[model samples]
Target: MPLAALIVITILAHSAFNGSRVTISLYALSLGASPLTVGFFISLYSALPMFLGVAAGRMIDRVGMRRPLLVSTTVLVCAVALPGLVPTLYPLYVAAACIGTSFMVFHIAVQHMVGETSTDENRRNNFGWLALGFATSNFIGPVLSGFSIDLLGHRETFLILASLAATSLFLVYRWRNQLRHTVHDKPPAAHGGAIELLRIAELRRVFICTGLLASAWDLFVFAMPIYGTSIGLSASTIGLILGSFAVATFIVRLALPWLTRHIREWTMITLTFGVALLAYTIFPFVSSVMLLAAIAFLLGLGLGATQPSVMSLMYTTAPEGRAGEAMGVRSTVLNVSHTFLPLLFGGAGSALGMGPVFWTMAGLLAVGGKIADRRRREVSAQGSG
Candidate 1:
């Protein structure tokens, strides 16, 4: 019942967070911000998270999930509500920063709960369900926000997001007692920290792959709005394009348990990145919204599978009593890319064109995948030896 409740909580929270994400770029543009400024807004969303993610993760490990979860959800209500009240470019930046920081708190806590509650036999499937919750919310959030913006305009759409966030807070508060408290049998060794975790070669490989996959997804969210606008797509059309990607993600996540049974995780990761390379390469050339949606769906299918697999690997690889810290480390790496890549892409989009930005991201993912595969082979050969 607790796990089920967690899923429900995640769906609402993720829906609110993603709804903000899918709209923020367009909002920035609407308020007279350029591509470069939009990048700043996107990067600002991760700046606080990038710096404080590990500390936040450690806090979860030290205290428990319930408190942080409550706090973050409460923060989200204010965060999503801010832009609606002010409705300006500066307020959007404040909204981005708050949303990013608050979500990081909420996410690391939930991941810790999921890891602590599940065992080896059921971990993969359990995480799959969590991923599905995220996918479902992703589908709902963008589409709902898109339609809301078309009908209600931007300010009122943000109101809807705040309402969803408020719903998440209420659910967590109601179920607070049902969520179990996990006490580590022994304290984690103080010496190692995130640095020591990085020393394990297999874990390192997982981080690299996960980071690349995460950044690709982030770039897609940021780029799609600008790309859609460039080709004269409506706000509603852009929402559908992004929402279709989420829908594809939802379908893939539903099949993940079965996919895990038949396909090795690394193999799946490699294939997904390969498909994404093709998707991004073709993204800039397509002008029709339908074609863009089709490509986005394909990209979503690949991107969605990578998460459960990589997250399971991270939890499995983490040192005892330190899963939260490891999850934070994962969040930190992703946020670092989230922090910088958008700024770089924004500048590139302004100077060169969106074409170069897409190709550059594809090339990075391709190279990262090859490195991951090579590292896996080396690890395998050593195990046999």
Candidate 2:
């Protein structure tokens, strides 16, 4: 039941996310907003969410999963609906902030729920399934949004997303009793405040890894489309290339259960970062849309493999009954990268060209991999003792 609910929520949330950048950009353009204004709005969506993630996590722990999840979903539905009703830049900015805030709450709740429900032995597989659900939704979202945008226009796309988000509320409502009883009913002995969550050494490693990985991921996803267009690719081609990445992500996540069982978490993360480094290193040299699609697929595979492992590692390290707070801190760290890296990439792209941006990302990924590898050895040594 929890898995089913999770899948529904993933589909709704991922679709909205996939569509949001393109839809908002187009909507803002229609409203006579300058490029700088559009960029500011987009950056707001990324930045605000990081700040909210920590608070949202606390809310989930305090109230239990169902209420926060429901509230977040409600806010998301309303946020999605606003673009259609207001049809202006300022209102859309407000909508984007709301969407960011709500998504942070919703994701933290879901991650906490998954952690609470699973044992350490099974947490990796559970998170892998969760990642799979997210990837599948990402796969479906862009293609659906592209066609919807073409067929119904951007205004209707927002309305459609709003409706989709509303469906998540239904799923959560149905599972409310189950989630509450499962997570909140047997509260643990009081722990220190949220700041103390930072004291977990293993969790610190997870956050460090998350921030680095997220930087690479956001840099690639945000910059690639703009770079592709600049190089004269059609919208359809860009969509196809993006879709290919999503499909590859889905394939990797499907195999993650078997993969996780056999491979150590650090080994998996190291491998992912290595592959990602290769992908970014070569990405700038590819000109053909078809070739771009192939590179994207490889990138997606590498990127997709890392996240669930990282998340599982974090959850395993979390103190009993404080999973929500731990996951929230992780989310905050991850989203902080998502918020800032794109701006840095954008600025670099403006100054040094896209080639430099790719190389810079590649360097970051390589460094991240090395750190994860080192930490893995340390952890293994400690475990053996």
Work out the TM-score per prediction: 0.85, 0.90
In model 1, how large is the Cα lDDT of residue 195? 91
Each candidate: RMSD:
3.4, 2.7
Question: Taking the tens digit of each residue's C-alpha lDDT, what string does model 2 give over 109-185?
Answer: 88777777887788888888888888877766666667888898888988888877888787778777777443444
Q: Model 1 has how many clashing residue pairs?
A: 0
Candidate that scores best on TM-score: 2
- The lDDT of model 2 is 0.80
- Which candidate achieves the best lDDT against the true structure? 1
Candidate 1 lDDT, 1-385, residue by residue in tens: 3788899989999999989986888788888889888867777778999989988877787787888999999999999989899887788888999999999999999987887788877777788889999888877887889899999999898989999999999999998887767755455656477798899776888888878888899899889998899889999899899888888998999998888777666777888888899999999889988899999999999999877778788888887777788889899998998888777787899999899999998999889879766755765687799
Q: What is the lDDT of residue 222 in candidate 2?
A: 85
